[model samples]
Target chain A: MNEKNTISVATMKRLPLYLSYLQSLSPDAPVNISATSIAAALKLNEVQVRKDLALVSSGGRPKIGYKTVELIADLESCIGSEVLHEAVLVGTGNLGKALLNYNDFGRYGVHIAIAFDQNPENIGNCVNGKEILPCEQMPQVCAQRGIRLGIISVPQGAAQAVCDEMVKSGITAIWNFAHVKLIVPPGVVVLDEHIGTSLPWLVGHLS
Target chain B: MNEKNTISVATMKRLPLYLSYLQSLSPDAPVNISATSIAAALKLNEVQVRKDLALVSSGGRPKIGYKTVELIADLESCIGSEVLHEAVLVGTGNLGKALLNYNDFGRYGVHIAIAFDQNPENIGNCVNGKEILPCEQMPQVCAQRGIRLGIISVPQGAAQAVCDEMVKSGITAIWNFAHVKLIVPPGVVVLDEHIGTSLPWLVGHLS
Candidate 1:
């Protein structure tokens, strides 16, 4: 990883797609795969794919292209796929429970260690094996676990308060599913997963 | 909307964020708001915000900025927020159920009219008032309802098959939560919500 060459967010988002594509290939598939083929299969631009792959791996050969196994390894390492990052989830609602039940997070190197909710009934309840704790215990639990990643699945009204608690507990990165924009201090990275936005975009583009 | 000046996907994604911010403001908030203020509130680049706003609105005035109410309307119209898009959801798993239970989609002009599942136990089951239909009935139900949008929340192995059924049912736009990239016709749009990608990106960026 070269410090000088910063990967753009667009590229970062596509890294997993590329990884998924590579991983999906059969073991008996070609040892070397060209960027053009990869791009074609993924419906991405060839030049863009080449540039994105270059950031993580040494440039592919002129004819032979990238070695499949080596490229996958480079992608996994670059995307931090091998490291199991423990994250705490706030709000054990439908979306939160869905995420907690989602088994694919382990493939991306994330584990929802615990869930916290303000609702009394939700506390002590288990969703996908992880216990949901009271909201009051969030800060202490997160601090004790040294959890830096916080997932906000709380409702719009409660998202900010949950975010504040997460930040106070040393969370630096936030994956916010709530519609509201969070006010975080400098150095805090917030990825707002506004699922609502995509629908409108899709509908607007419909011919 | 001007077809000549096409809005970028990046701009489309940010429109909802801006709308959410504007909506969050109190009724007593100033009638006029500037791109700089919007940028500051959202922690986005001022120039980018101005450029995005320009695409949907008649460019803002030099001193008064934009009329808040009119700007909101322009955004709503541009994003097709006024029209309720009927959509069919495939897979009655946790993610699918979460989406069906999601009330916020109505704000984004989307209504999941029906849900489909292959499991016999899940079929005919109701979630958030909408009943889950058999997967075999998906094509017929979607086609009869004239559904243009389809949400694919099925597991990886089943995603492509569901996508195929969606396309067959006249679904031109797909909100795919599945990890696999669906191969659709040139005009068909697929917006993939790869939730797993964000965590690794967040973890990788952590200091």
Candidate 2:
């Protein structure tokens, strides 16, 4: 089967920014908004904003600009929010707990079905109402659920092992939060969510 | 002063990946390796690897490739790790605590000298030995310390107020983790670290 329409990764990253800003505005505040307004508010280029918005189904009017409510819905579909994703997280450390408590995930259609940890003290506990199961049960539970996305929040030493387990358990895509570079086999997608990279990128601009 | 040598943000993001990969390899293991080997290992293009490595001071030999040790140090300098940046973090929530405990920051020359929170119970607490102070003291302490980098890990509602306090106290750059797009007056750099964006980007690829 053919895949859905594609957007560049750079453009995909900016969609959430536009979505959140649109969500912040009152439905009564403006019937339509020009790309120029969004560009000014978000410090983005006007042409880029228009290009990104054009990827959505609904097009902007010549003078009235994009319809506010319709744009939000288009963005939601563009981001695949219509299809709720139930995934598993394999770490209950501080970052894992932070990801659990992060409320924004719900808006984006991601729900952590369960979290796994090796710590005996944390195994029986709960984070944001999601059970923290033993690492041994990860493969069984994730496979039984047919989960597709796996989040690796483990330490650098344990990240690869956890990723292998996730892939072995039927996870097709992995969102890695570990510091090290993971080696995943072919056909599996890995998104390295390295927060440290932002520092250098920001510093480069600051310099 | 003239700004240090420049590289594109895309190239800057990949430097850490190469650095970490190089750090994993033993210098004695390979006297010389070509960009093709590095590209194959990381699933990146050979030309891109060569292009990125060229930005560093040291040059690669025709067939021997770059000296691993020199490349590592050059990558360190490329990312500005040689200059340790002392910054402050506000919001000692789960995410804030995660940031404090993240050991990778030290390797990147980012030290969260202090963290601030409004929670009375957490004000006197500590994470990774760094004191968590009241928000009221942020301006004073940051001003006295001459802090230039501020990290806002607070909730959406409180992010702007925390950012304002940081700016008022002389913070010139901000690493914001809040879900909102902040309005910073000109001169202050804000890097919004949104984990949610990754989800859509990943989904876009998966679909």
Best by lDDT: 1
* Worst lDDT 10-window in candidate 2 chain B: B1-10
Per-candidate DockQ vs. reference: 0.57, 0.53
**Which whole-number lDDT from 0 to 100 does residue B80 have in model 2?**
62
Residues B1-207, candidate 2: write the lDDT tens digits.
Answer: 112336666676777888778888875777666777888887898899988888764658887898777877787777766667788999988899999998768665678899988889999998999999998998898878877888998888788888888889888889999877888888888877877776766654444
Error of 1 at A8 (Å): 2.6
Candidate 2, residues A150-188: lDDT per residue as tens digits?
899998879989998988888888899987677888888
Per-residue lDDT of model 1, residues B78-165, tens digit only: 7666568888999888999999999878866789999998899998899999999887887788778788899999888888988988
Ten contiguous residues with the weakest lDDT in model 1 chain A: A1-10
Residue A85 alpha-carbon offset, candidate 2, angstroms: 1.6
Model 1 interface root-mean-square deviation? 2.7
Model 1, chain B only, scores a TM-score of: 0.92
Best by TM-score: 1
